[model samples]
Target: MQIVFLIEQVVNGLVLGGYYLLIALGLSLIFSVGGVVNLAHGAFYALGAYVSVQLGRHVGFGAAAAVSPVLVALIGIAFERFLLRRFYREDPILGLLVTFGLAMVAEQAIRMIWGAAPLPASLPAALRGPVIVGDFLFSRYRLLMLGVVAVVLGGIWLLLNRTSFGRVVRAGIQQPDMVAALGIRLQPYMTACVMLGVGLAALGGALFAPITTVHPAMGAEILTIAFVVVIIGGLGSFWGVVLAALLVGVVRGVSVHFAPAASEASMYVLMFVVLMIRPRGLLGEPIEKFER
Candidate 1:
């Protein structure tokens, strides 16, 4: 029974980790290339969840889930062009302040549009059942989430490591001036990165909507955990973020089972320990310039 319980917790942890990976992937990409710590990321996620719910009601679950990320990605591109582009040459602190303000604005907008109440989101009928694996049963939707995360991560890895576009992105991260000197356009690439990041956040929101309540303030709550994941994994390291998210998820899941009171606090405690031991984070490289 004890072993069975532990296995169940591990499965639950993986499900949570999938959501973290989707969100953190975008956060890491934006940080790595744009050098911006986007506080509004969670806002994008919340927007996606709300959009998914509304669209789901009108068009069915499949269409809603498919459309949400694409719409959110376009909004992200607009934000990059209108807002983030202007701040690129400014001080990093200024960018942070701008995004922080944007986050607040997004939350208020969500409240005004959706009200303060939580909305219900449900999995499609096809994904509503549980799958039996030995003596354990697992939600099909969660298993689907794991598969989707794997595909996204793998696709991102290929894009970054295998393609010329990825080479330019890596070069830009290391030395933006050199890339600019070579006459490679940086704006488009940066915009793409922002869109990709925002899209991932939106995807996470849509995926998690069924399991969690969707509300105006939801983004603020998840933003804290996302930052913790980013810090523990190390800024700008893709795989690092993935590993750290999984670890945090496992810690949180086990804590919820063994000590419900401490479940919420475990992530902060883990962050504290990581900071005390390695200020740079588990997989993070030392930044030439400090990034928050």
Candidate 2:
């Protein structure tokens, strides 16, 4: 019985971790490539969820799921080209402030469009039921989410480690000026990074829409936790983000299962402990003068 309970908790942890990974991966990429904190990332996430729900209601679940991320990515590209690009050569703090303002604007815009109420978002019929594994039963949608996240992480890993674009990104992160001096246009790469980040955030929002309430303020609520994952995982390390997200998820999941009253506070506590021990984060590189 104890073993079964443990397995169940582990499954729950993975589901939560999958969502966290999706959000944190994008944040990590943006930070590493663009040096932007992107406070409005969660807003993009909420936008994706709202759009997905609306589309799902009109067209169909499959079609909505397929198109929502593309639309969100286009929005991200617009933000990158118009707003984010201007701040690339300026102070990082400026980008932070701009994104924070954008986040507020996005939240209000969502309110005006969707109202403050939570909307209904249902999973596809194919993923509506639970699957039994040994003595425990797990939600099919949760497992599907896990599989999607795994595939995404693997794809990202391949993109970063096995592709020429990855080399360019790494070089830029390490030496932006040198790359620029070599005649490389850093603007396009940065724009791509923003799109990638926002797309991942959108994906997370869409995936979680069926499980959680879809409200305009939902982004603000989850942004803090996503930031925590970024901090704990180390700002620019993709693998670190994944590991930290999983750790945070497990911590929160176990807390929810064993101490429901304290579940909400556990992630914060974990973040505090991590920061106290490793101020630079688990896999974060030290910021050099060039990076600044």
Candidate 3:
């Protein structure tokens, strides 16, 4: 029985890790391309949940989930064009400070518009309750979420590995000046990257809104863990982020079963240990612009 319970927790943690990947991958991508750490990234995530919930009141949950990220991606266009574009290739601290302030403003806006209370998001009755397979049990909704993440992951992998756009982005990460020398403008790519980053974050928020409490500070909460995943996975490695997110999830889940009190702290501990072992992070590679 104890082993069975442990297995269930592992599975649950994997699902949670999938959620973490959606945010961390975007953060990594934006930073890799633009050399800016987006503190406001979580703000987009909060917006996704709020927008989806509001949209859900009108359209169904499925439609709300689909539309919410698109709306947030539109906002990301402005964010990159007006704010982030200026910070690119500038001092890293300046980018951090500006994004941090943006995060504060976004949270306040949410408070003003949505109030401080948590909003309840529900799935359709057909999607609710437990799913059983053999002796293990799972949330029906979470299984669906897992499938969604898998599809997104595959789509992103294909985008980055098999496309011309991805080739330029990759070269830009390693040699922005060289890409410019080749007469390839990167502004469009950076904008698209930011849009995709925030869009992914929003998608995560929208998907998880039903299961998690939606509040103004929720962005901050997830941001901390997302950063943890990024740090553990390395600065710019896709597979690294994926590996780290799953590891963090599994660590936290195992902690819940064996040491419930330490569940929340487990990922941090894992981060600490991994950093000690590999300072650049597991699978983290060197990028030129970030070297200085």
Candidate 4:
């Protein structure tokens, strides 16, 4: 029974990890391609949830979820063009400070627009129940969320590995100077990268709104966890983020079951241990820009 219970917790953790991946993977991709640590990434996520909820009230849940990310991606285009574009090759600290400032501004905007109160979100009747698979129970909505994440993951993998756009993006990450010398403009690609990154973050926010309270500070809350996943997975490696997210999720879940007091700190502890052994992170690749 104890073993079964642990297995159940592990399964739940994987679901949680799927959510983590949605947010963290974008952060990693943005940093990998554009060399910007988008502290404001979570703000896009909060916007997604808030927008989805508002749209859901009128358009219904399915349409809202489908459309929210596209809306956020549009916002991302403007953000990259006007704000992030200026700091691309500047001092890294400048980019960091700017994004950090943007995050604060976004939070305040949310507070002003939505008020400081938390918004409650609900799923469609079809998605509100649980399923008993073997002796374990799972949220019907979560399984659906997991499936969506998997599909997104597959699509992204294919995009990066199999497309001409991906080839340029990959080259830009490793050898921007060389790509530039070839007469290829990377600015457009960077814009698309930001769009996709924030769009994924928004999708996470939209899908997760029903399960969690939609609040002003929710973006800030998730940002911390996303950073952890990124750090653990290493920056430029796609699979590293995926692995770290799942590992962090399982560790947190198991810790909650066995040692409630340590649940919150478990990932941090794991991070510390991993860093002690491998400072570059698990499967972290050397980034060209950062090398200098």
Which candidate has the top score in lDDT? 4
Candidate 4 Cα errors over 4 Å, as ranges: none
Cα misplacement distance, residue 179 of candidate 3 (Å): 0.5
Which prediction has more favorable lDDT, 1 or 4? Answer: 4
lDDT of 1 at 267: 89
Q: How far is candidate 4 from the true structure (C-alpha RMSD, Å)?
A: 0.7
Tens-digit lDDT string for candidate 3 (64-131): 99999999999999999999999997899999999999999999999999999998888889999999
Pairs in clash, predicted candidate 1? none
For each predicted model, how many residue pairs clash, with residues at least 3 apart or on different chains? 0, 0, 0, 0
- lDDT (CA) for every model shown? 0.88, 0.86, 0.93, 0.95
Q: 174-218, model 2: which lDDT tens digit per residue?
A: 788898899998888888888988999998888888889999998
Off by over 4 Å in 3: none
lDDT of 1 by residue, 1-292 (tens): 9889878887789778878988888988888877888889999999999999999999988788779999999999998999988777678888899999999999999889888889888877888999998878788888898998999889999998999989998888877888999999988889998999999999888888888989998898788889999999889888889988998899898998899999999988999999899887888876554543
lDDT tens digits by residue: candidate 4, 14-88: 999999999999999999988889999999999999999999999999999999999999999999999999988
Model 4 accuracy (lDDT, Cα): 0.95
Off by over 4 Å in 1: 289-292
